[model samples]
Target chain A: MARRSSLASRIFPFVFGLVVGAGVLYFFLPGPPQGGKVQTAQQPGAKPQPGQQGPAQPAGSTLAEVRARGYIQCGVSTGLPGFSNPDDKGNWTGIDVDFCRAVAAAVFGDASKVKYRPLNAKDRFTALQSGEVDLLSRNTTWTMSRDTSLGFDFAGVIYYDGQGFLVKKASGITSAAQLNGATICTQTGTTTELNLADYFRGQNMSYKVLPFEKNEEALSAYDNGRCDAYTTDASGLHAQRLILKTPDDHIVLPEVISKEPLGPLVRQGDPQWEDIVRWTLFALIDAEELGVTSANVDQQMTSASPEVRRLLGTEGKFGEPLGLSNGWAADALRAVGNYGEMFERNVGTKTPLGIPRGLNALWRNGGVMYAPPIR
Target chain B: MRWSWTDPRMRALVWQVAALAATLVTLWYFAAMAHQNLARQHIATGFGFLDNTAGFGVVQTLIPYSEESSYGRAFLVGLCNTLLVAALGTVFAVMLGFVVGVARLSTNWLIARLATVYVETLRNIPLLLQLFFWYFAILQPLPGPRDSLTLLPGIFLSNRGIVMPAVETTPSTAAFVLCLLTAIAAAIFIGRWAKARKLRTGESFPTLIVNAVIIIGLPGLVWLIASAAFALAPPVMGKFNFEGGWRVLPEFLALLLGLTLYTAAFIAEIVRAGIQSVGRGQTEAAHALGLSSGQTLRLVTVPQALRVIVPPLTSQILNLIKNSSLAVAIGYPDLVSVFAGTVLNQTGQAIEVIAITMAVYLIISLAISFAMNLYNARVAIVGR
Candidate 1:
């Protein structure tokens, strides 16, 4: 026993001493210059020198990179009907995917010059920031913290949304306040979860939250009576409600707890790339305002009107500064129709979602959506 | 080089030193690379996120938790939930395993066949599928809270959870707990005393009776004394669901049920192998000493079987603990689901979160092995 204990005693100190010594070495040894400055706030366009032997990835050069690679890497949602969903043949469509295709057309003059990567809410920010995707066209909610802190810049609002609750009509939960002590289900790792807590806590009510990694799982749980209510974007509730057994049996609550301006995003450092995407979104909306339908875009290209000619790339060199051909906007408009066309094709009153264009209509049509003109 | 290689001890030492150096350099390089990448991407790396408000709620929590609580508290809640599942799973698995293991060796043809079928069926099916079956198939199809299946007067099962009556708080709860601890201490002392007396006199003392009286009778007495303040709280139905009772959420039930059923199969095999390992002559020797079949199996077979049984049992326990992390699939708020999934996503601190999570499992596995080793040493024949 004495000998065994002595051996244990010796072994323990040696192992512990090695650990202590290694820990000390780790702390004292100087690392790279950029590693220590862990800034709480992000500064866009800030570039630390690249490694000695590593390949150069200059900040804000996404356009050149995409051109060099011969395809744009666009991050989209895993599946959200009318926003980003793959059809039976694995062909991706919806407003978000349309924008990705539009960006591809602008860059390569071919709508198919893009590879789609499906991202969940948690992975979208990292995927964009890590240069895994050239642009993020997922239905990501644009927020101040995500824009500044996470090094992402919102290009433009593709869909305006707000947090709302979906409950069975049989339960008669009219307002958000009536959901006190009710269990809510939502997709985990999103701003929607935080909004759920804030809304409940702000009202001095307690609610059990059941979070699922996948939105479909959460919706399934809500359907199976695992939760009393499902909370997410108002638009999402409308879309998800269609999949329920009796869509008419559930009601979207009146309260809009938080604003969720759903938009495409890009890494913050790339001003040129950000402009290209921002303009692509605006081009769609502007095309709608200019009455440039996909059917009439070819004919309009021959029109004598200067603004119409400029927009269709018949008069000016507008796309040159954005590092593209003048026909880029025309290609984008042709690829996915205009913004109105994109909206009408997927999520408008005609679609299964049957959602009326409430806040998503153009400003000229008495709605908040207004985009800058292509000069 | 040949001369140095001829000395095995020296060669081993040199190789070990070289491997250690290589490991250290690789780790250092990776750390440097990670630091550079994080910096280049402008992602902060630190444990500061632990202090940030979790800003979310969980379906079930043992300890007091709120959206206002820090991420650290959420981590603690997740850890507690994990331990709760693992500890309960271990106990149930071992109990069911011992029964099944013994049944596999039963002389009755039907009983042995049934046990064999059970072991074979569960051992072959994947655990994740079983967890899904329990969660999505079985529990989900149950009635809603309003139409819960009432098993008894105060016991109900719904999709939300199994609700049952429980003892409400007592004003003298601490005092009662204290008396219970003292009773356990007294029982241990009495057992030792009896053991010593039997060694000296060769007349066995009834330690079991003394232990039962001390352990149960004392606790029962305390409960009786405190019965005035203690109350049973039955679940009260409300507008939408039940109001007050001890609630076990379906996620917890599914995870626990799945883990126990899956792990018990392997543990049963281990137990069977252990029992068979004990020599037939040992049982014969016990019978020759006028011991009954039951007594021979108990006094001679089990004690010896335990020596062989414990090591493999420890591995099974560790597997159960690790498998409990699959709770994420069924939305059980275990450590992986809450801390690693939600917390990691929210804070975007993958390195720190994953490292801590890996360390937690490592430490838990090591500790279980340590405890089992101690028990194994005690059960091993002395001076062999």
Candidate 2:
């Protein structure tokens, strides 16, 4: 009887202690966000697919709220060079980074009033939809499903890209068609994986895909001969190829597998916020077409041309309807150079990536990047 | 209320029911909130996505899977891969743990200290870093398939993967296996009967030799009878890769190595504690009975130590299973990698995918505890 009681006593206290410890730990954990942070949801479509539960309180338009908040929280790529990578001083620089600066300039009239949220590919849309960021200027592709189903508005195509492969020169693999039975390395949870699958299947070849959660891991794995080819957007291949140990040894394949129209996206519900982001992108392109560089944006305000005057926001009230001052376009242009200038500075022919404008050049330049008039 | 408080049983029942109701209410509230939030966002909240095509390829699938397969099949493939790694990892860990645990207690200074250093170094470093080290630093840098390190005549190692021979099962091979299993069962039966007979009579049978003959000789006879039916198919070098036999891909090897080495560190310490908990008097008692060291350890120590070992060992096994989710970092395509990482992203069914994945882990952890508890109870001491 004594032994049984002793065993019971021992078991009871340990179990009780564990429960108590768990309770204490739970209380010690940081509580959920308070102070008007609303619960957010993400779906893909015009209508709620299964159910719809609106917020308890109307938080009002995302525009007024961002203005009230000091800075625009811009979500960007975790670290894609020439897109949204950070420098040695932890300052984010890239085409995507410059686009965020343009958005900040349009809203707050100061590009410096922008904070960056480095997000993974999978979480980028969610971050935008949840109001964790004012806008997602990541190197995200615009698709019909993302526009209608996910309830997001793609501002514009910032860069036109296509899926391709990088292989070692010594491997003598010049084209993706020769990559039959090849093992491909790429980042998981992205459209890149699906594109690779479609590309290989369409070519009537069998291949294996080894996916990593991070781009760096995938790159290193590919470098180590763990895979025969690495696949991503052509621009990403160009940018990331520089990091290879023997950068000159690897060559990106010739075939472009899938259309990747990379752009910035905002949530669908707020028209004002959507207009602000869209026109800001347009103003950058318009400024580029008008030969208005950031260095001469303030000087160009005195130009007599109606198009330049309207694009600089001096001849029209386009900024008024978008809920910003008249100099919103001018501010955006002055903060980040025109689209072409920003492209050249970060990832174009002048940069180490040495990428030709290709499909990203404007309409007059024989590329498809055309923007609507500011007026 | 005051009158009921005088009765301890009544008070206990009231508190218990209240607590149960509170837990149920909390659970219902959260579930409802999730449903409402998903609805508010226009996010489709259902398991319908599981019926859609997976459309992506997994690196290694034990079951039949293709791009045309449904997401449900993909989920199963991921589950099976997870179970395979966890089972193999646990088995390898226990074996390694026992050796290291015993070595820690050895009288040899160098061996004991080395075991100590191994345990301390591994247990302190994060498993993720260790996994990266094994993958990037060790496995990834191996030579290409054409220049594979020949481990043996039939085994090859390379950056592509490890190639080894696999058995080519034929019609007579099944018979050989069944014959071998039957021989083991007969050997156990003879051992039991001989033990009973020896207890009854002073005379003894040579049960050891007889059991060995039944176990080895019977299987040997089956093999001899069907000699031509079985053939060894060793891995052969091809132009670009191995032509035949099984290939242990580098990702799988790296994940398994990381999991086994990391979990074994904790298991070894648990074993060391369990063994130490056995009273010194028990060992001394076995020595006084003139039993050999091995017999003493087998009869007196291990069984007693198991009482202390099983509980913690169960936790470590569960930990190993959970830690296998980090396989995504190295692209092993385990449950989290395939289902949660890939499928969740593809379908954008965050809530449902997360819930289903959580339920799977819960079921697996519960199953482990259930099996371990049954074994634990059997070995538990009974009061005289």
Candidate 3:
């Protein structure tokens, strides 16, 4: 009995020590409660006191925080050919990438002052809202719920996209309506899933949704005939079709179901920062409309047009209103030429994506990319 | 007055108190921190979201569910999937483990070598790699439904899923249940009779043969009667899938196959160790008593070996349960995938989602440990 008592006594402290250690570890471990709320309160649209000069910082103040950090943390996709993929030389290019450069140029006057963080569709919002990225310029669609509920502000639409269905030509399916009772492959954690459901339900047609966790898996399943059709953003369908064993084997259906406004996003609250980002994009569009390509931007900066002079920082103090340097817009324009230049250089017919500028053209060309006057 | 610090009882009490205090303090700190942080982030810290609509659909739910269901329902679906995979994996692993364990001790050189090779090769590779190989290399290569690989009549294997003819029972399933109960009762009666006859007459009866006959024959008889009483429904092949058959999704098959093969290797090692732990003296004593090889193993070796096996085997079972979380990697919609990934995204409540997920896993682990301990106590040695 004495020995047993002794053994128990000896074992007691050891057990106690383990419990204490686990408790301490748990205490130190990072959890959502501690940091998440504070960050949300700091978001752009977060309420500020009367004396407070500007909007609250979202979780991470993307604008001021990026400046303090000395490098713009830009979120890009892992690899989407002709979008945000890495080049043969290990440099990131494409339209989505140039937007990141444009943001960097506006902030630091050097487009190269950026650190790209690759994220998946599911993780992109969290990365931005968590302040891991200064800007999210991935091929993400802008929607109402994402805008209000997710606590992020979207800069204007850069690409006008629509959802489309792709099926094998051999299946003799010409339209999406013909796909009743079909098995459709779609990627989970995106608007595509809801779009597919709404479209089918709206048409009073029944179909089976075979959702895959990744786009590649969905594509592979569709290619292997596991599903009768694949649905995604029309642009993504075109990009993925290029990699198929037989590029011509599948045909994208003509029916476009939903409007997908793709653009860059920043966490909400910092109105000053939001304006800076919004105007940077507009500057690119306005530059292209005024025929101010990167090669001629230097020359146009000295020209007499009051709108150009104001935009080029030769006439007004628009930059001061946003608390930026006078030449910020000019810096952004010089970084990636303009919106039209970015499109032609990245996903144009000259490139692999070969996307045409349909609804993405300037207002002068009868498209919807109209920017407010610089004055 | 003469008590020293080395006194056992004193030491044990001191240790317990110290441990208790430390645990309390640590819990207090984390609770404080979590409260503070959640308050700061404007994130709600509660399980209220469980009442909110899930707004997403699960691919393979055993229960009927829809997008309009609550988050609580989604959690149930995910938990069901996890249990489904773990149960199926455990069943297959035990059968394969026993075969391999026996083969490792086989007299035939080729069989022994083959089993040894399988154990070594599978044991070394990571489970994630095995999962990928099965999902990508094996399942993805299967032909589509238009040209499915038919294994047998009413059974087909394709890239989509494994389809088999299911026994479609109606309200008359009660008849089948009665048949099953009759077989079990017959088997028990035969076993008891065999035991009584052996004890009274000092003569053994073939209990195994009698039990088998009662179980199988009674079940067969009842099945016939049940079928006659009720119309038997047959499976028919439908477009894309079998209409009246049970279908196992490709994700489930991959996860189940991967987990079973991966865990069986570890189980084989455990079984080998247990058998080796039995003393040679016991076997020699059995031989001296003129006991046959099978009798020595069944009567002498196994009983001793089990004592050595049960404790470690308990831990391995717990490990298998915990490792089932890896189902997320292959998109099997286990607790983590559905609750943490999908629900978190839909709700925008990361803190609530993560906390719930952690709590669920802890509860599962604790339940397994409790069950294992109860079994352990029953099998433990009693002392005077």
Candidate 4:
């Protein structure tokens, strides 16, 4: 009986081990059989909406879900000078930084209520899709592929840019046509690299590309004369040109190769949120067009014009339809002025970027910054 | 104390089973979550995209490839480049390792110190940093083609690459290669016969001298006869760059040099340990048997030391294979760089691209292990 009992004990543990191993194997071996079924439950069904056919999200959904989380999760670049870079005190400041603050102001009514997450170009999309950031205000280009295929909604163009090339003055090269057979330094995983190829190929010019993982590396390479020229967004070139030890030693070529409509982005499947963000930008543009600066916003709030009164929360409930308070636009404007004010303060004539308001001007001035009428 | 139901083995088995079960449950939950999430996102989970044409062009390729070629072909190109780098790196590393390893045990103090310094300095730093130093700091600083550094004869080294005079094979060269193969086969047969005669009659034959003469001399004779019979075209240098000659890009050279030098440091340590593992008694016994130092090493030391060296050596080889992934940092389109980075961005299928890349690496690693196992089994000591 004792021998039999001992044998039973031995077999019991062995059996237990086998069972446990099987259990572990089961878990490790690609999950449950109904795995695919679980996924469909989370994805929303297709639906069309007016004003924007963007991805869908719940109406009046949790804003506290963003704020009680401490800071408004804002994605910015790793380091783009003048646009999104840390100051000596490690505080981020730039045109993109202000956009993040503006979004925070619209939500929490406090511009400083933000957590800045720096992301590289390659990781920016995944970061957004994975919901690591609530909004992406990096200097990202808006393209059809990114919008439709990648499942991301662009929140209106914040910066109208075009591709340009910068060469050392010593090279004496006046046109991009003369740059045939020359090596050009450019950042990889960007629209600029593709634009460079397209432009050169169209001109039937053969040039070697020296690609760098970071924009700073490419810029430094160009500065050190490692390549004959550097190419990127004209605004980026302007910003980078300011940091040059010998700024006058280099000059931007006259040719503008490709149009780059830069903007903030949000993940797809959130139309309610997309509309709110999109119109927030439109409101700013409209405010600027209607001559509503932050300094004069209080006076304009009581203006006789129905549109000005409607925008400043004095006359209409426009924000209620978008699941925001009537004062959201007024708060955002107070925090960061109108579009024209933000532009000049951040990257316009007053700033080192000195980007002229060419295509970025209001529609009445023959530019494309047109916002829908505030009904 | 007397053993009971709570015996050590029983306890161990029980604990192991519990741990395994818990791990399995966790894995299942995570897997289910991923599946549900990916499905919800409408991302395709299969390998159908491999059939799609790659829209980008590769700067350098060994095979016929175009922008319209399928992703599978791009994958193949990446794999080929990876293997090419690994193979070339292994050859150079072995040669360098032996020299450095021997020099470490040298009588000349300066030479020994130099080898020591080289090994210590290289082995301590990370391979990626070394690669960057060589590529960016060393190679990128080279003058442009207008002021390219000219080497002896028609060779030049610049930031672009190394341009060397190359030979173009004519029709007669094919005949020469055939003759060379035939000569090598004849030499092998002669060597076997010579070894057999030496063993049977207790007579020595200089097989090495004979084989060299047959293999090299016969091939040279055939080449001369072919050239006399038929006119051949030789490669000539052209303007700007060598027209018909092969040019090695600076990126490739930098990667190759970095991988080889860094890997050689580890290989030297392996070789040193391998040589030292054989006991002094074994060498004394070899000497007692009237064998020369060279013979003693070949017959006694290497066989035993190989048993200890090979397992660790196999791991180092696998490491070199994986470390080749760093080629992305330098713009060499190895598997990870081309497929995972470029292809993933182009296709916007991160999950699929990463999964494929991981699977390819796992397969390569497994194949290496399997081959090494076969070799290990062949050389393993047999039971009494």
What order do candidates take by lDDT, descending?
Answer: 1, 2, 3, 4
Tell me the tens digit of each residue's lDDT in model 2 across B217-253: 8778878877744777987765346767888888888
Error of 3 at B114 (Å): 1.0
lDDT of 1 by residue, B100-125 (tens): 99999999999999999999999999
| Candidate No. with top DockQ | 1
Off by over 4 Å in 2: A1-60, B1-6, B200-227, B236-240
Residue range B1-384, candidate 3, lDDT tens digits: 226788888888889889878768767667656555443433344566789877665777888877668999989988888888877777788678767876787789999899999999998999889987887788878987667788887678888788877665565467666766887887888888878988898888787887787777765775665554345344465554445567777778888888899888887877777777888899899999999989998898877776776777667666777788877666677877777777776666675677667666666655665666656655656444
Clashes of each: 0, 6, 21, 2
lDDT of 4 by residue, A1-375 (tens): 123253454355445555443433342244334643432222243543332221223333325457568668889998777678888888998878888887777776788998999997767877887778888999999998677656678999988889999988877788888887676877766777667867877897766665556677677667755578899899888888888779999899999999999999886655667777788788889899888988988889889988898888898798887777887888888888999988888788877778888998888887888888777
What local lDDT does model 2 show for residue A18?
45
TM-score of each: 0.89, 0.90, 0.88, 0.85
Candidate scoring better on lDDT of 2 and 3: 2
Compared with the real two-chain complex, what DockQ does model 1 have?
0.37
Among all windows of 10 consecutive residues in model 3 chain B, the one with the lowest summed lDDT is B36-45
**Largest TM-score belongs to which candidate?**
2
Q: If the candidates were sorted by their TM-score against the true structure, best first, what order would they fall in?
A: 2, 1, 3, 4
True contacts kept of each: 0.31, 0.37, 0.15, 0.11
- Report the C-alpha displacement of residue A15, candidate 2, in angstroms: 16
Put down candidate 2 lDDT per residue, A1-375, tens digits, no spaces.
Answer: 234454464355445444433332231123322223344444434432222325431323677778889788999888888999998899999999999999999988899988999998777766776779978998888877676556577888899999999999999888888887788999988888888878777888888899999999999999999998999999999989999999999999999999999998887656577788888888888888999999998889989889999888789787888889988999998899899999999998988989999888999989998998866
User: Root-mean-square deviation of each candidate, in angstroms?
Assistant: 4.2, 5.1, 4.6, 6.4
